[model samples]
Target: MRYAKFSMDDPFISMAEVRALVEGEVHFLAGVALLPDGREKIASRSSTVKVSGKLLSASHDPKEVNEAIRGRCFSIYPDVILGRDKNMFRALYSEATKGVETSKRCPKLDLVFTDGVIVAGIREEERDSKSLREHSMKPFSQSGTMDPFTSRLMVNLARVRKRVLDPFVGVGSILLESAWMGLDCVGVDVDPSMVTKAKANLSHFNYQCHVIQGSVTSLNLVGGFHVVTDPPYGRSSSAKGATLRELYAAFLSVSAELMERGGRLVFASDSREDWRDEIRSAGLKTVSTHLIYLHKSLSRAIYVVERG
Candidate 1:
């Protein structure tokens, strides 16, 4: 549905994540757009504009914009007008309510202008970053723990309502986020210390998840899980004697076997090596790829793959 203007944690990652989660038509507008089957997903949770109309000219005066907004809000009978900031849209809101009586509480007409385009709609939802932050601050966190925002994004991108698996769960970040989204989660790690810490971390959040200490390649897990993981990487990674590519190839090969038909896998890596051959050999199809630049020397490649 239509979304309001809000700062994304990372626009590129958010866009890619939304595309992966949404199953139908998607259209990008000025400050909002239409997304199919994403009403309940996290990708839609940050949106403020619930219902919207066609784009309007950014140069339109307050009166003209208000008239257009009034036409869109006719069915809802919004009593309050809200803008993204106290700038042009605020003037528009004031002008719109000049001859109108304000209600104590009613539907709100929301406006957002971006890149010479104006989007008008009705307000619906707001994101709670505070609660998300609280959940992210587990008692036992480590350097490798995934950030809550990205963890939640990855879980949503998986688009699995039933179950999710993180084969390289570090401190239970992915598992915790999946459980927070009301999905049954399982996490496997080769390090017993990590597994124990992950379990404790989940407990601190009062979340229930299966945390096991086992190698991802040898784990006897039941098929049918949407997997999302950030495997061990870098010079300090616990890859034993194998190269990064070799470890990734082995994990993907076994992951393909552990996934149900049509299951999706979301992976992240910092390696600059090309993995097209490894991905194909693992019997998975690449759905999308995104690159996130963390710093001058560090960039991550995110891949969304589907089991064949």
Candidate 2:
């Protein structure tokens, strides 16, 4: 399990979200070239299964990355992202916990390090750098949002071939994240604007995706997903004006359809509604639950759920 753990780029919150995103796995780490949409990012979509052939994984602890890739040829470079401050080189070095200095001119990372310490740097053409800028994002935009949190999740989804579904695909944020991570994402949304917005957002990054304007209860979902997680806002969307009992029933049905046998199903929802019965009816068992503060109005709960 050499998967990488991507840290949530939220300055206000700690790396706990990132830790949960990878389920305590670390292999590699890279700060995004961009800061994501300047809005609140719930989670950093990450690749859970670390594929050896592709040679990439999720890692949050810089020490873990340093220890794992110590003897191997490595390069630590920041993406020449547009919106982020040029000072990210320092922050990334700090996160890597390595006292390394990189210039602003170089974009693609190409270098070699000794004991997590940078010995020398190289240009894009230098070293064994396989310069593949095929997925470069378009100009920065404040129109849609995607912080490091969602991006990490998307990458993890790219690592496997499974039913990738998002129940509450508001503007297809997670879908965009998954697409970049190299996975085919299917998004279900009730709002047509969200579908359009998702397409626009995906187009901004020059990505192709599948978006469905529909409800979660009866989603056009085909197969089971490898990892299914979404920030369900009852107070705002699906749960609005409905009783807890009614909401849970709806969630149970949708959740069940989203997962396959032994598929990892993680969902974040407000605790205002009871989940005891829904957990059972959905044929999913609770693994862990954490209290999260999603602003003041909504109470956030991250539940590690699995289909049994």
Candidate 3:
């Protein structure tokens, strides 16, 4: 079995489970998760996952861990724990490997204690901090641009089959994540300036994506592409003279048209209303909804829908 440990105390932590499910079949217990083995790639690229590894053992007794890890060449690495005693787990690890032989250079083992479960596993993948830092520091940025981790989460939620489309792409925040996953990317914006900025940002990261200056309502493209976008919230972003309701309805209609049957679309909105009417009208099925509190006055609802 494989397991993932999520960052604690994040308002977006709730989305971690959904993201895990979207990427692979996994079960969440508190902030720690157990996923089927052979999902190293999925765990590596996930925004919410901190560390993932092959489980060696999960038991209260350190002898079980010691027995499972005997004769294995590994170094003990303690990961940050949530809702558990860190030093206790460290001592447990020390006890488990006291007499066992290990190699300090490669194949490290991570000790994770959370929700009263003790897990010892062989470390396989970790978050790419350097890449994430570079993506977050893109040359062109705006006030309402989605944060890098959240942007990546949106893309991951879509589970892009082949291509990704961002109808309200602003500065290519979501597109960059899609590009990082080596997926074909197409971005459209009503504002020509935003279109240019999006292209520039994508190019800055050495990502080649198709950027078009057009409204989602009038845009046309081949079907079967997954969609991920964060539409205008009308505070720092302009609505282009369309009400939130109208803009969202149009967005849904266009998305439904472009997506093939069973294609996924993950979109975000700041409005409190869930847009059930628009979703039903567009013949889309609601898969799930995740609420992320950005600040005191700004909470965004991320909706995952499938074209039917």
Clashes per candidate, residues 3 or more apart or on different chains:
0, 18, 0
Q: lDDT of candidate 1? A: 0.66
Rank order (by TM-score, best first): 3, 1, 2
lDDT string for model 2 (1-308, tens) is 22111223441122333344333333233322111222112222222211111123224345654443444344454332223434544554455535443445433233222222221222222211111122224233233233334334333422235457766666655666567656767777777877777677678777777777877666656666755446445444445566646665686667776677776665566667657577887677876565555567766655666677
How far out, in Å, is residue 213 in model 3? 0.7
- lDDT score, candidate 2: 0.47
lDDT of each: 0.66, 0.47, 0.79
Candidate 3 has an lDDT of 0.79
lDDT of 2 at 225: 75
Say which candidate scores most in TM-score: 3
Per-candidate TM-score against the hidden true structure: 0.80, 0.53, 0.90
Query: Which run of 10 residues does model 1 get worst, by summed lDDT?
Result: 73-82
- The better-scoring model by lDDT among 1 and 2 is 1
In candidate 3, the residue pairs with backbone N, CA or C atoms under 3 Å apart (3 or more residues apart, or in different chains) clash, namely none
The C-alpha RMSD of each candidate to the native structure, in angstroms, is: 4.9, 10.4, 2.5
Q: Show model 3 residue runs off by greater than 4 Å.
A: 11-25, 84-91, 101-103, 235-240
